[model samples]
Target: MCSGDAATVPGGHADRPARPQPHGSLLNPLHLLYLACFLSQSVFLSAQFALLLYALQLPLSPTMAGLLISLGGLGPALIAVNIGKFIDRRGARSPMLVALAAQLAGAALPALSQSLPVLFLSSFISGTAFIVFRIASQQTVGRLGDGSTRAKHFGHLGLVYSVATVAVPLAAGYAIDHAGFAATFLGNALLALLPLVAIASSIIAIPGPAASAASGGRGNSAFALLRDPALRRLMVATVIINGAWDVFMFLAPVYGSQLQWPASRIGTLTGSFAAGAMFVRAIVSLLTARFTSWQILVMALALAGACFALMPAFVTLPLLLAIAFLGGMGMGVALPVTMALIFETAPVDRAGEVIGLRTLINNVSQASIPLLAGAVGALIGLAPVFWGLATAMLGMSWSSRAYWRSHRRKGQSPGGTP
Candidate 1:
């Protein structure tokens, strides 16, 4: 049996799946992998938009609409860790295909019927499948290279998702407006097919699970991975970052609606966030070349916190978009860097599980943070909610001070992957 070491990175070199050498063109392994990721993410987000529009068109109650929509996140929160473990044992391919297929089926469901139960089931299926595809994609990418290259890969990956974030919603909105809800949902399903075709084409070889993954014992527990101090800190940081993001996404539209802003203006505000994120991800490799991942992450948190603190003061569309853009840049840096660090920190054999844990944390934050923020916003105000999260973000940044300090003092060089 191949030992777990088969997947480990040592001395800045990684063990990757065997694949053909690129022919010095754009259509290489990494690009193909990115294509698959882009297709999957597009389908997920577009389907989500279609679902919300369909629910509202159904004249569902606001409470019912929220509940139905949130089931997608709930599905991932409940099963992400388990999915990770399965990936660790059997490999990403089987799980990825299954998840993508489920995504396809889920997207197609709304096309068949506008029934409440069908929408609920579709929401959960699409959410769960999207998370699985994402986790699998991350795990696959993590194994593609060593530390520095992995950082670059993740930056590119982040860019792909950001592009999808900005573009997909607009497309989905247009599609829903013209094609109608069922047709839009069906289109999402059709879009999901590209990823499956990409995978089947074998342009990128996703690594199989290490043999040792199947021989897991005490050390393999997903929670046990947190025993590594670095990992624990990273997890805490991820929770804060993801929670802040979820809250902003939730709070922004509500605030805009309350102010009677048009959908186009609200879209601009959110689109600016994605634009900022996209801009930063495009240049993150240069940033990483001069700074360690931890440094970038800490700065990102502080910057985002500052943005949040400044948010409540701004009411104009241009100003709000600017603040949102800056906040997005801050968060944009933190996210991919966090993913790179987690993969670098975890045991190679348990990479998927570690990714799965992060996914679980993110999904949980996505599901619950908005609800809590909504409740708190209703009780107090959006301003306090923004300020409260700002404080939390700043606190999280301060908590990480000791980590980067100690690591730097121990002779970790600038630009070294954490």
Candidate 2:
């Protein structure tokens, strides 16, 4: 994963060193990163929703529709690590532009022709592009500051994503109902152009590969990072926490249906979850200021576990909504805190690779959790699924005692310095 003194390939091109970033530059790279991510996220999420609806309208089998959706994650899961290495070598801007272009083409494909193969390809391309953009942006932002500032930036990014999660599907549904599939898809393709242009205009100054050698020594392989006990613990916690999130997403609809709740009620319930996440992220800095990142994360997991344990016991809308909201708050805090910990713990030079590993973990859970939960829930009932996830989350929180304790013994913050 390490390169020896990577030549100063600034902006992913030219032999010259990167220009010194002006301290008082009107446009901060962090702001540009957020803007680009918001736009890219909008296009990617809306495309998936629009495509799924279109597939159903075209009378495609549910299986085929699901496959089309699945393809989106499949492509990214396979190449995320390689893309990370590529970003480490070249720079974020160039690879980001390429990814956005691929996403644009992906969106435009179904507009040109709605053939089954074309639809699948479009999903894969758009999905892969979105993930690549995400990893690059995360890497860039992680590099932008030291501990506290970096944590704050990630909190803001989490808030941005929460806003998108709440808004995009509703917008896409409205667009599909009014404009039709081709137009919606084409509109997303057009939307992709905004971020593409923004990044291309050099609104964000991505550091070149020459920055990689500042950390000193040959970097370890991405997989080899697991040898570090702290990182390994973090990765394990990531899977459990992310799996809990995915499992709730899978269970919510089915659980609602079992209670005979209407579609509007279900939608509101999910909206409440998003609202809770947004609320937590909005105040994350205040939380981080008082409590260390690990302390917050472990407490959040405990809260989520308690919420899950209570979910199956209630059938009332208000009660269920409260539980979902609480769970969402827990996850919301956990997500950004996890990012801060990873960035703080990883070698500066290997941040991208570690992020890629985290992405890979998330993708795997996204693809597998539903299948596992469905089969197990069918056989054992949904209560166990809820309780099972609860046990896992609570177990993770309890297990983290050693990590935080070790840090306390050394008088080091569990997330490293700051």
Candidate 3:
């Protein structure tokens, strides 16, 4: 899995000069790579959403549509750890290229065939490729700099991603409504090619592990990483915050449906949330400069909880949009901060693996939370789902406070603190 050209200095090479790290410039190729990663991911997600709707139109049963949609995560969840190990052993470049190719093929499959089997296969391939692409991009950003510089880069990364998250789905939905599903899928496949080209053109400049660091040194196992108190707390916080997002997306539509809101109004509610997220992410670096990641994360969770708790009571469109926007800001602000903390605290050699582990947790949450929300909604009502998530967010905020206090009491500097 290793690369021949990869910088790998043997042990006792103290005299060997360190390889030059990128200057964390906004215009660097690494940033370009980040943009490509964001676009690829956005396209994949939008297409997946579109695909589900398309599948429903194919006269498939609701259960069958759900199955087709969930199939995308199945392959990635199984092999994420191995994918991380491969990136750690070799480098992100090879895998990034491979993921792009897989994305192209995955998008092509659904466009070319309307059969259920082909769609299932497309989801599997696309899901696996998405994880690989994410791991590579995250690893590169983690390695691009340290401290504030790293935080700034990650802020920019999250901002682009948030923007794409809001815009791409709307665009895809428009295309689907106007041009039809086949054309939309075909366009997505073509869009995947732009990133593939970008990556191929900038292959020489993609940031990766240094020679000495990539020299086959042993590192902590994934379980061992989990055992670290700080990382464990980070993981829990990540799961909770990310899980809330899943719950919100699923529940918002259900809530709207129950209230007899039009589909366009429901879309606006969700879009408002994304708009809030995009707003905070745009200014994340400034916020990080003044507050530690832990502080920001805790406060964001608390605010998000309050917003969620209030969400069930709002029935008017403007009022609902306002609550969703505030809640979006709460949820949006935590994402990059959490990610920055994970990278800041991770073992250098194991960053890829740790990120893979995080992705694994996120994928599991995305798959399971909706089903959990649905069951809970059926048993009690949709309001309880929002209330339950509000409770979880408040709980995680408390735990985050405890985690930071514990670290400080032990005289440990978690870094990125103001």
Candidate 4:
């Protein structure tokens, strides 16, 4: 068994020096690579969304534009787990290199040919690349450190993406407003080079499996992880909370449009949410030290649900922004904790597969939830959408309580529970 003070041994060995802990400096090559990868992802997403807006300006139908934009998500949902399997068998380096190449091609394609077919093709390729990059990066990060160090790195990773989520869009919008869409796409394509160079230079440093043993026999698959009752509860909670986040993103703009809120105000409201997330992520290490993952997940979900439920009741921008901030805090706190829990609980050899499965679940939810919410909004009105999400979160809080009780019965400490 792995101890807090001892390093985890490979091949089920109880006695061995643990891998070197990650350095604290942001200048470390691995940390730089992490930053670059996240920045690239942010740029890619911003550019892709900008592409849709540009498509609309090109007189493409809104439906066609949406289809083009959604193609990015489609590829990942289909192949994320397979890519994870490849990472498990081979290593992160090759898949990361491949993903970068695809990202380059995807960004360049649309810049070179502004046609509908090229746009569609680029979206699919880029989307697939994005997922591949994410899985590889996440697996690599997981391998970089142990215990608290692992948790810290994952927290930083989440923060980078959170910041990127806010910054990239604003930057992309500015680029489109000034330099135009093609320039923005070309810039993103060029930005992809930074991570490529970083990964290439540091390829030798990327961690590999300590041993060649797989998690279990061939019958033990990614889906099998879901069979663990505790893990299942965590996964369900993650799915519901994340699904609510997607709904909020979708409904926020739609709701703003209905209320005739200015674009600037709507943007600020959304940005507030990101700000809240960043704030919580900034302090997640300290928070994790104090609270159990179960407690964090339950509290964040319940609070975020209350925030969502309150959203429809307000018309003033300040109240809305406050709600957004609170909601963001809830999600922000839950994300890293859930991620840490997954890493803590997953079998060592199957880390890549399990993370990929998590990605697959998240991708599926993101893709499907918004569509379903939109449909429900059309039938009953948008207020119910937020209400429904709120109710789901409130319900998940009880599940969390059950999990907490079960853990206590097993004599597990808050920090000790996987």
Candidate 5:
């Protein structure tokens, strides 16, 4: 049995999972890779979203441009499972290497191409690479942190991303406005190099069967997660919960722009969303102390959906900020809860692979929902689209009942739920 190690990091406190004595074999390498991913992600967000704006300005056609923006997400959807399986058996190095290469391709192509097709292709590849990178990093969290410490590690890792989200976009946008597009792409390429170096320096092997065996391989077998009625309900709720994000991230700015908000505030509004995410995570660190992940998650989702549905009433800065705060608070519970469920539902050995698969599934929804939301917004307007999201979240409210049923059947604990 794994011993529990309790630890705390920049915005979190959680009961730790006991880890084996450090072999100094696989763990070291994985450590470097995780660091690399953190650095890359930090730098990546700086200019990643700007790609869509670049397309639109090429102003590429609205439909085509939107697709270009979405291309990054598309690639990950195709290869999420493959990435998980590779990490499951081959270790994180291979998929990470490929992911890095794809990111390089994604960054470089746009720098080189004025053509739409090339941009689309590049975006697709980069999107997939990012997904794999996320998987690799998340798996590494398991490897690096003891089970007892996983939440703390995940919290710290997340903190880094949160910090990056704050800084990268501002920097990236500034760079794009001042420097040529090539410079921005090159900048991303430069950032991508950090993870490559981290991976090269650190020496953890990708984890394998010692944990859990991938069913039909991690990539193709996420469907098995569905076979567990409990897991299925969890996933469905997660999808809806996750789906609302698109409305927030992808469409909120569009709505703001339509509202004739100032250009800088537009960035801030999006940044506000990120800020909300960061805040929620910090809150997660605190809330986990008293509340169970399940309790927090259920309440958070309910609150977030309410916020989104009612956001139409409060479109101004003060109101938006309040809504953002509410969303952020809810999100703190939502993300960790989803992740904990994904990691816990699977056997310990398979946690890494399953989480990877989860990333893949998440990317698919994240990529597609923007288009759907955009379509809905096109027809009924932005507020209605948000209402749709709110409604879906309302549906998600019922999910907790199902999850509780599963928890009882499995005899899982409350806070840890594992």
Candidate 6:
């Protein structure tokens, strides 16, 4: 898991290297971290969509269903900054161990669940743990290698999630159709095994804070990200894109229901989103070899925003499908790119806090934006929420552009420095 931070690679492709994969493959300890991250996260993320579908068969209303999803999410959102700070103070090991435990506990609830209360508590446990694992994975990437490999390493990690996310839902759908909700949780239980492997295999240790004391003391909260102008700008960008992505994902069920779409069709609509996101991100991996991440961000956000602007106008199934594809593509590309930027911009020792802060902002929007969509959807209708989301994304495009432009100037010093 150990390697030098620097390596030779073409520009614009900084995150992912242009070189071919070396003799060491997934068996390599460093690469195994990527494998572990990919497998465990897919279990959490894919089951997320599958869980709601399972809930749909329950007595819960649409809003209640949404509330449950939000509730599961709330624990992580509230605790991420604190957990992140602890990672910065301590290291990835402890938080990651805690996260896996939480995930295992949470995943089991649905397997054991016979009632609503049990389901919710399980979901709550999951929400708390998943974020810790996510932050730790990112920190592991930072600790195990240098900037030369971070982007490419992250790109590889993204590929694993993309592939697994695609498979999990289809399998869950089958399980839901035949074996029922608890069966899907069985897969989740299986996913929990990945963390154990990671914990056992990690040869890389999280460096103590004194390793980079110049970044300042461990007492610095997640709020300390505000001290860096570039980092603040990146967080703002994450919120904008993430919020816009949620507007449709959160409200689309109502839209489909209004259109009198069946459960199967509604499932397909969301499935289409995952499909599009999965494919587009795969493309981004190749594109990264040619384009700088900033360029990719512009392309992804512009198309995503444009897609949001178009969502309301579709009445026919084909039109809806087209919207889903565009929206999904945009959604897929934003996440990995954002992670690359965060790791690229922040100091390695302090990466946990930066990711925590960035994730905290994203979690706020993940919580709040849907509420905005529901309220706004109640008012002008869901169609207009797409337009509103599109408008917000447009603002994001400009702000993100400006933020990067300012930083580019700073990075362009006679002797370049971030």
Model 1 residue-pair collision total: 0
By lDDT rank, best first, the candidates go 1, 2, 3, 4, 6, 5
Model 3 lDDT at residue 361: 86
Off by over 4 Å in 3: 1-26, 174-183, 210-213, 409-411, 415-418
The regions of model 5 sitting more than 4 angstroms off are: 1-35, 42-59, 109-121, 145-152, 177-179, 203-220, 250-271, 315-317, 374-388, 405-418
Error of 4 at 407 (Å): 1.5
TM-score of 1: 0.87
lDDT of 5 by residue, 270-355 (tens): 66666777776765556666655556667777898898888878768877877876776676457656666555445444555567
Candidate 5 positional error at 47, Å: 6.1
Residue range 313-389, candidate 1, lDDT tens digits: 98899889889999999998888888887877776567788898998877777777888999999999999999998
For model 1, the superposed segments whose C-alpha errors exceed 4 Å read 1-24, 214-219, 253-267, 314-320, 378-380, 412-418
Scored by Cα lDDT, where does model 4 land?
0.76
Candidate models: Cα lDDT each: 0.80, 0.79, 0.77, 0.76, 0.64, 0.67
Clashing pairs in 1: none
Cα lDDT of model 3 by residue, 1-418, tens digit: 1111233234211111123445567766666767787778876887688779878888889998878877787557767777877787787888988998899889888788879888888888887888898888877776665544555667778887877776887898899899988888888888778888877887435655545447774655686777666678788878888889988988898899999989999999998998888888888878877876778888999989999999999899999999999899888888777777776666556667778888888888877888888999999998888998899898988888877777678766543343
RMSD of each: 3.9, 4.9, 5.0, 3.1, 5.8, 5.5
Lowest lDDT block of 10, candidate 6? 9-18
Models 1 onward score TM values of 0.87, 0.90, 0.86, 0.89, 0.78, 0.78
lDDT digits (tens) for residues 30-49 of candidate 4: 57767766866875687587
Clashes of 3: 1
Q: Highest lDDT: which candidate?
A: 1
Candidate 4 deviant stretches above 4 angstroms:
1-18, 210-219, 257-260, 413-418
User: Lowest summed-lDDT stretch of 10 residues in model 1?
Assistant: 10-19
